[model samples]
Target: MPVARGTKAQSTKQPRASKAPSVTENVPPQKDEGCQAKRSPSSPQGGPKKRSAFGDITNAHKNQAVTGKKEGVKAPTNKATRAPTAPTVAKNNEINLKKSLKKTPPAEVPVEHEKDSVPEEPVQQVPVVEDIDKEQLGDPYANAEYAKEIFDYMREREDKFLLPDYMEKQPDISRDMRAILVDWMVEVQENFELNHETLYLAVKLVDHYLVEVASMRDKLQLIGSTAVLIASKFEERCPPCVDDFLYICDDAYKREELIAMETSILRTLNFDINIPIPYRFLRRFAKCARASMETLTLARFLCEMTLQEYDYVRERPSKLAASSLLLALIMKNLGGWTPTLEYYSGYCAQDLHPLVKRLNFLLTYQPCDKLKAVRTKYSHRVFFEVAKMTPMDMMKLEEKLKS
Candidate 1:
């Protein structure tokens, strides 16, 4: 090759071929050759590897003989190398970690199952006591059938005297609001331990006043609450304090507002403190019957309960109140109704059966979902004890009062 004048001449002789690279390339080749030698004679390259195998055997024997001559020993056989074992300390730690991960045993199962665990026991079916056997008062029509007379009287009263406008108008007290008031009253009764009659009277007074006086512009709630306050004073020996009432009301009404309302209620009733409450009549009649205190108390409960009934509006508050108390007393296993209970009490006793039957028809013949609030909310003193009264007597009394 040509070179520039300043550059050194290139060597013509090539470096010798390296045995190391050749040995590496031949490594797999050596294994392949060994494998071929082990194959059948039909292979293409089988002859050379077969001769090499015989040569290796001869060379191995020669090497053994040479080793025996030099050191009086034979060559060792080829064997695989073993991997190192884990340290004893590391092995023990790994075992302990596995043991720690294992779960522990649990505690006991309850023997007496909770009510929530199993289906609730079916509500016990209470056996009903028939009114005929349990009651001396007998059926409402036991003495006389008065439903037609009473119903007609009611229709007459509603048509003639109830103020057509008033009858048509749905008052400010919505069903929902009335429910709220009833619940609130029940809470007040429970909290204050007020007499059921007193609470009922308060409720009725509020209702009656609202029906008679309130307009769309008036706040009915204020009237109802105010009425309750007044009735509490009239009915209880130790009347609930105004602060307590305020607390019961959660301070929704101010002290001044309550005083103002009390004044307003007094003015509306024309300051007539003697409102002829049913409790007075109920107590008097119950005493005359020679009934047990339980009976009288029951009767009083029934009488007070009547205040919640829309149908009882036609009945004299006193008569309805008396009959209800009698009913409650009877339910309490007290003395039954007597003619003297009706006649002397001026309750139109002959008509009581029919009136009570009508009430029962209203209460029992259909679902009593509405009255449930009264039963569950109030002490249920009245429902269990009320007596029968005729619808006609109720109508007559209602007519006289409205007129």
Candidate 2:
């Protein structure tokens, strides 16, 4: 046996040498002394110093970097000794990690079933208003694009100007008195060659003024004349002057009285005289029915007749126009209330039947001597003598309504 260098002999006893060489036998004696001096003093002194597992791994990484190849590093075979405070630090870190996880909420993972269970908002559906002026695009005077919107706006404004049999509120006025005034206004419209719209709006102003202010029969003529003066200014491009209105009234009211009455009427009605009238709506609805000149004239006759009747004061202008046009179509043997008419006029035949029957009854009866202006106006050949035409019988009207 050969004694190892840098270590003390156990008993100074020499043993027989084996045929195999010792592990340090190939190394020179001077290299063994240099390696023993370079090792840490804390290593065991029994034999050559042992290298730590960290040193072996570091040396393997260096070898690989130099050789440009990855070395397979093995785990340490011996149990590692940790630092004195390592267990306390690890336990504290674990407890802190648990507390942080408890303080901070977990991420929200959306579940497919839960997502399906949530209710969605309902979508609102809007009512569609039809465009009836498409064919009149070439006619700039027709205002094709804005025609529907314009009529819709007028229909909306009708609610603001609505009357509720306001004659009941007047102490000095009766329905017959109102009818007489309206009849005279019609004659004034014809005599002055004022637009039909001028007549309708003049009547509207009178009724609206009467609704707000109490009036006597003596001042009624003044009110009527002032209304015409205001309406002519509104509807006529070359409206009749104040002198013309004064002349039409047979000088019943002086210039100052008429002018004063005009101010009174305007103030009472809050200066909002852009009233929706049956005449304008009648023309629009007649166009929707594609009514012939005779049919339209007859419808005009029906609408004008209602203007003189105090009973029709509560009717919506649009509804009155629709009902009048429907009756005209029936009398002419034209089709019943059409979808086009319903879409544009906002009334179906059923919706209009009650008023249509009333209008037919109006035409059926002979007018009294006092209220014959509307009948006389329509009886002219120039008006197609629509008043001379027979009214539709009640039974036939019912049959038509059913159809």
Which numbered prediction scores highest in TM-score against the true structure?
2
RMSD of every candidate to native, in Å, equals 32.0, 23.1
Once superposed on the true structure, which residue ranges of model 1 sit more than 4 Å away at CA?
1-171, 174-180, 215-218, 325-339, 362-373, 377-403
Candidate 2, residues 37-148: lDDT per residue as tens digits?
Answer: 3434233441121235224222222212111112112212231121113232223333433443343223211332334335432212323444568888999897898888
What lDDT does each candidate get?
Answer: 0.48, 0.73
Candidate 2 Cα deviation (angstroms), residue 57? 66
lDDT of 1: 0.48
TM-score, per-candidate, Cα-based: 0.47, 0.67
lDDT of 1 by residue, 112-196 (tens): 2332335544433432322222333457654324533443343343333221233235555454455556556766676777876
**Residue 122 of model 1: what lDDT?**
42
Model 1 earns a TM-score of 0.47
